[model samples]
Target: MVVTDVSRPDAGSPGTMPVRRKRSRIPGWLRGVIWAVIAIAVISTASYSTGAAALTSSNTASTALRLALPILLCALGGLWAERAGVVNIGLEGMMILGTWGAAWGSYNGGVWAGLVAALAFGALGGLLHAVATVTFNVNHIVSGVAINLLGLGVTKYLANLIFAPVSGNPRQSPVVPKFDTYSASFLSDWLGGLEKEQRVGISDVAGILRGLVTEVAPLTMIAIILIPLSYYILWRTRFGLRLRSCGENPVAAESLGVNVYLHKYVAVVISGAFAGMGGASLVLLRGGADYLENQTNGRGYIGLAAMIFGNWRPGGLLGGAALFGYADGLQLAGGGEAVLALLYGAVILVGVIVVVQLFRRQWIAAGLGVVGAGVLYAIYWSNDTLPSDLIPYTAHFVTLIVLAVASQRLRPPQADGQPYRRGED
Candidate 1:
């Protein structure tokens, strides 16, 4: 009998067996199809007259970053909860609580105090989720729902109680101060002739680039720093491993000497803290907090979508958040025209699709995303007139369908929604 050479590759010999190439998981034809679709869409869209304007409007970097920041933070929070065996359906409620806390804190103690209070309150809310789900063994989904309801009701009641209708300034909350702009002297020195201009002189492209890049917001810098730190803490550290293990198989993790309960509690608390900070960022950076019901405005859901789009990765979450932010900026800049609204909707839908698909196949997904964006541009340019109100509704409906279908096929981690249990895999 002849011995097979299967083990020959691992034998201690130099240059004895051929090196096996890693097989490509994605098919070539599929990639080709995706690329083709993207190419066609881009060419068609670019040929249209309004394509330039739409692209320019969509690519405004500052506006996109600002809009994306809160969603990014929220998604990161969700990532933590899910990674640690907790399903946080109550992110919306948490956001409301945070907003209310920040407002109350700012009202009493000022902006700094409001921020600290929001983080603390957010952690408290997380504790609520952990106690109800982890300790009591209640259904995670139900617990989340309950927390959301409690948050909404409590926040509203508190708003009324504190800033009642009797007060003329019922809707108002203390505003946080904005960051200072670059000093005139610094700007003038950096960009020659800027001293003569009101803000920064726009003599050339270099000046414009300097102006755009130089004016860094505090939150923006914070966000950039947090992304890598979050990634490191979640994947590279021992604590992160324990948290993941707990989520994936709580029983096994418990048997391995991991404190499952503590991990779950910590995860939930962190989730809430980030969410609270996000709420504060929205109010402080965007505007002062107000007592409007549902003030978070579906941002929680948006954050959830972002988490899925990001595949629960910190860096990916930031990218997803930025895309959504760009969508928002487009809506703001386009002046609510029917065509513009439709175009914006199309862009968002396409972006979501590309991100989700990219998880399965990077090149194919990239091609498709490019194509989808191009198609949206063409649609905007081809139309001479668009109905404003109907466009947003229509776009929203289309996006909803696309997202629903995409989500159905995208599987989250196996331990995504389970509570960490003590001992036994």
Candidate 2:
């Protein structure tokens, strides 16, 4: 009997069975958007409980905006690096260094001097990164790790040496002058009840709105403005073109008459300077430029994630940073333990499921996973003690994870990370 096996196709036979074509899954971008919407809906529903209702006010929203500013600035700084073909992993270190410089400068000179000094030192750090990664051709990741280590050591040493006192009293640096919070002023004007002289309660919706708009410094505005400016520079300007070329294909760009080395240097310097400004903002707004060891608190890394989440676009970074900032703000707003825990776990689980489903495209699996997580959170909340103060932290953590995963699905420009070497393809 001339029975042919249907499963196996003969190598040289004309009657070979055709291979089945695999269908393309949904685009990552579309999946991400859908997941994001789902996650937001889940969070909103979870926050609709009586306890969460008490927490959701104008004040809470304002606080979320206020916290978002510094993160936005840091994300911009990171964006500068990534856009120019370098990954800046040392944002945290740059921030710490800037904080130290700004604090020290403010203590001796003034706030303006502190700001300038911070930028200068930040530029210097960028130069170091440039030299290590671009000029010497070192691994960018290792160089960043080195910078973080150096920043930690140097900032700590300076803080202890300068701030630590031999006597009973420790000498400290002056605080940055408070800038007008336009958001707060506008909110107050719009809300119509808050008095200029009245001490508004933090928990009050009006109070929170007032605090965000009124208390946020002018630097925050600067950070927001940088978003558009950065986009223009990166996509519209000559220098930006050269910078991008170097990162995408240095040899090719170098061959095509672009100064790959110089462009890389400029990119790192710009990135470092922005990161430094972010650090200075912290001191000026919150801690004062006095050396606080590890004051940056991983905002630098968060900034990197923001850049990715924004798909390396300057304008998009603002939203990404704000998401993280909102998380941090939620953690700070102190709520009841059980409520906070439930909220935190739910948000995080939703974020994770959304990210995974977006990447893997297992819609059914993802739905089941999220459902399981919700159940687990319910069980845990029934037995565990949840703290209110940790709400913002939990929120920020969940948001950051979401941003990170979403960013991976984003399609960056073709020439994003290659150095522009002249005459090379």
Give one digit per residue, the lDDT tens place, for model 2 in 185-235: 556676535422232332343444454565555676677778878878887
List, residue by residue over 1-425, the lDDT tens digit for candidate 1. 23334446444355455444566676534643564345334322422423333323212434556667678878988899998878888787787788877777766776677777778877778889989988988898898888888988888777777756444454444344433333245653565344124231132322323333554566556767887888889889999999988778778778788898898889989998888777767665542244456778878778878888767777556655765765565444444452354464456556756776676676655575667677666766666655665544444443444344344235465777764445434
Question: What is the TM-score of candidate 2?
Answer: 0.74
TM-score per candidate, chains pooled:
0.74, 0.74
Residue 8, model 1, lDDT? 61
lDDT of 2: 0.65
After superposing candidate 2 on the true structure, give the runs of residues whose Cα lies further than 4 Å from its correct spot. 1-47, 53-55, 165-187, 192-212, 286-290, 336-385, 388-393, 404-408, 412-425
Location of the lowest summed lDDT over 10 successive residues in candidate 1: 195-204
Error of 2 at 245 (Å): 1.7
Q: How does each model score on lDDT?
A: 0.65, 0.65
**In every candidate, how many clashes are there?**
3, 37
Residue 299 alpha-carbon offset, candidate 1, angstroms: 0.5
